[model samples]
Target: MFTATPSHNGYSKTQSLLHESFWLDNPERPSAKSPVNQDIEVDLVVIGAGFTGLWSALEAAIENPNWKIVVLEGDRIACGATGRNGGFVSASLTHGFSNGLSRWPEEMTELLRMGSQNLEEMGDRISQLDIKCDWLVSGEIDVATQEYQADELQQVHSEMNKLGVSAQYFTAEEIRARIDSPIYQGALFDPQVAVVDPARLAWGLARELERMGVKIFEHSKVIELQDSGTLVRAKVGAHWVSGRLVVLATNAYPPLLKRLKHLIVPVYDYVLVTEPLTSEQRKSIGWLNREGVGDSGNQFHYYRITEDGRILFGGYDAHYHGKAGVKPEFDTDPDSFARLADHFVQTFPQLAEVNFTHGWGGAIDTCSRFSAFWGKAHGGKTVYVAGFTGLGVGASRFAALTSLDLLQGRETPRTKLRMVRTKPLPFPPEPFRSWVIAWTTKSLQKADRENGKRNLWLRLLDSLGLGFDS
Candidate 1:
């Protein structure tokens, strides 16, 4: 009945087999995690062990070690998108200034600026902590895939220049010189972006939090919440624990949070990692293998080269998902990646037989404006943050702080942002949802091919079918 069916390794994601191919699967969680044990009480309980949860625990710990901080995770720490992301520590947020301004006023302008700065600060923290996350001080190429996209990006260019964010607009030849890909007319290269091993960094932070005396429990899938006379209680299996406050950091897994379920529409995004490329292969593409890259297709596609010379390409433009269900192709599901792979190979013909050795998918929580949703709740104790729209890697830290602000009832950098709450498309489950998502996939793909961007009315129709139901 749920949509967690595994998209890789012939397992279902909803079956609790989410750990095997996840980044944490490759390397052990930074700290040894104890399985859920007897009922335990703490001053604060943080749900989810991803970046936000880990940071929450860490911040709480620093704020007051005396206050017992309990971190609960459904899976291993960093097992979710925290470890599975493109690892672009974008000094800026996912939503550009213009995008934010359109949805919100200057409230998010300085706040988002702070978020960008926070990403850089996190990098410094990693370096200070000496976490070997394979971080690289590189830029990003936000390529424009269509004429309309190019036009919008031109506005982005002008805005970036006005804001002193330091971005460059490359010509088709300029981009082609950087990489063998010829699919983009131009790109926005920003120096503030950096690439890192996401899983490693997240895991490292988890371990760091543990060393800081934070209590982390895995297999502690919190199934319910309770409001005690004096504290909030979260249920795990047969036990219930009480805490003064609770933090919900579940991003794409918002469904488990019950109240936040309707606030997020879980959509799956697929990723394919290519086998290690040879020197000839790498140099032939001239990707420098250093920059984080993504295109401006209507559905949006993001890609980057890994530390091992492999390419990680993934996006959410094609998955066939429902409000509460999912239907995917077993092999080269939906035929989007295969086509994308073919396009990649053609762009750089030096790599032959380029089969994706590892392909995986995950859920992303997208709101109407694709802006993050962060706030405090449950009588100023249950703080929560989610809705990154595939761009949470860097901002998650700030988002956590935002959640904390809500929890503490204090002014924070997070409260300065605002995103429109979009009601999810009201479509009953089943064949219709699958059909709509399938149709959306086709229409978007076609639009991408025909114009590198979707038609406006087509976007309206697609958006109509997307978003969380309030």
Candidate 2:
């Protein structure tokens, strides 16, 4: 069911697209603040002003009102994956229920409870702070594009219900009545997900942090971290911010800690946002509820309707550029955009005339386990977190809180979980790393084409707990 080559219509629709994220393309975006010019001392220093960093600062300031907190960002706030995501705020901290069930079935119940609590607290904080980010609590539907996938989704649905999770399994005819997609064989709908303007959420958190007396510096990248006596010194340009504790929230970017260099690989994902749909075009799709939709595949697509009725379609091709790392030039991939455009048209033939106005790509910090891992450096004075894969929007707050718990040496419920106590199996070093990822990608694509049958390579990875079930 995949389009082998993009047609002329697909290519033409994206010919004049803007290479920027639709969420960040806002006129009301705040201007960048001045970077650190001189040495400063603070109680807590959080690096990177994305969702994780902002949430860390906010929570820290709330817990200790008098503590001096400083946030350092390399660019404007939320310019990285934080700004370039599909904005699905899921409650599953372990990527999804099945992934968590597979990896740590013993603590899956606690993990689910903690994830749900984290999401509720986040929503409460957003309401308490009055952060306007087009927050919508319209749940998510994982649709099966193939018949085998439907059977798999049904199994997942049954398992979820047994765990006291609320879910609805939709048949082909039942789902088509709701979403009007031709390829949906069946679907599993989880009513615990939400969507937001992610960039705006980050910005609003930054605004609230500043209002709470947290000092923030934009365009200041932390190049080095050193242990200076009892305090950790973060070098931003020529200036140093010395702090009693530091939180590393730099997800997907090159890490300041050397050990992290092998624990994560920045894999690029692309997205396309179409212009707002007219009334006639809107009626053609019949997506009145505007729920976030994702296909059930190893390689899949996630699409949703924006506030203004535009469709934000992303995922499918996860590109790893060997060791080029994260760079501005890799933000645009024409082939990925064309493929997405073709897939979009195929999914909604009535929207064949729709044109995309924005196209972008950003890297996701992929780990072997496809979830986050936490560690401390400089003898537990500095705590760091990465590897949220692509589902960090809501989990970032939990990560922030847990990192704080570690920095303060507190034995909270969040710290005792096996998922928190253990780390993912490190990825193989360079050359071989590239070879492994390439082969994995090829095998995943092959499986998608062959009725979800895993070959030896994928099965081996699955046995090793690295194969992503989607």
- Candidate that scores best on TM-score: 2
Q: Report every candidate's CA lDDT.
A: 0.67, 0.92
Best-performing candidate as measured by lDDT: 2
If scored against the real structure, what TM-score would every candidate get? 0.85, 0.99
Error of 1 at 306 (Å): 1.4
The alpha-carbon lDDT assigned to residue 466 of candidate 2 equals: 81
Each prediction's RMSD to truth: 5.7, 1.0
Off by over 4 Å in 1: 1-22, 25-32, 254-257, 323-337, 419-443, 452-470
lDDT of 1 by residue, 94-149 (tens): 45555555545555557557856787788788888889888887888888756677
